[model samples]
Target: MALPERNNEGFLENAWQWDKATAEVIAAESGISLTDDHWEIIGLLREFYKQHEMSPPSNRLFVKAVKEILGEDKGNSIYLMQLFPGTPAKTACRIAGLPRPTNCL
Candidate 1:
């Protein structure tokens, strides 16, 4: 399928255009396989965007938010980093089809 327009970093230009197929393509580009674990976090990020209309804004906030919702076992940096290498929040938001986190790099 023809994916929607994306930014230089591969985040969807319009989040409303996102879907599972689009996420799969983007995750493949990032070398991610999107297991259930990944889906759990992606769902959280999507819901967060739906409610707050923005990404977590930084890795710290991402971790904190996850901890708040999913608890420490899933929310810690090590766990998140394992799922999304480099900057966790940035990579995750990109794959989740949300706008880039404001304080992420």
Candidate 2:
């Protein structure tokens, strides 16, 4: 299937075009092979976007949101960093086919 258009930074131009296949392609570009753990966060991010219509604006907020939902065991920076290297929120939102976090750089 043809992939959806993305911005220069690799985020989907239209989040509505996202799907599992699209996510796999995007994640592969980052050398990530999605596991159940990855899917857990991805699912959360998708639901978050559905509910809030935006991604967490920064890594700290992202961690806090995760901690609120999944608790500290899986929500800490170290764990998220291991699952998604380099600015976890940015990398994760990209892979989740969500818009870039407004304050992430």
Q: How far is each candidate from the true structure, as Cα RMSD in Å?
A: 0.6, 0.7
Candidate 1 lDDT by residue in tens digits, 41-69: 99999999999999998999999999999
* Residue pairs in candidate 1 whose N, alpha carbon or C atoms collide under 3 angstroms: none
Model 2 Cα lDDT, one tens digit per residue, 1-105: 678999999999998899999988888989999999999999999999999999999999999999999999999999999999999999999999999999999
C-alpha TM-scores of all predictions: 0.98, 0.97
Over 4 Å off, model 2: none
State how far residue 47 of model 2 sits from its true place (Å): 0.5
lDDT of each candidate versus the true structure:
0.94, 0.95
Off by over 4 Å in 1: none
Compute the lDDT of residue 61 as modeled in candidate 2. Answer: 96
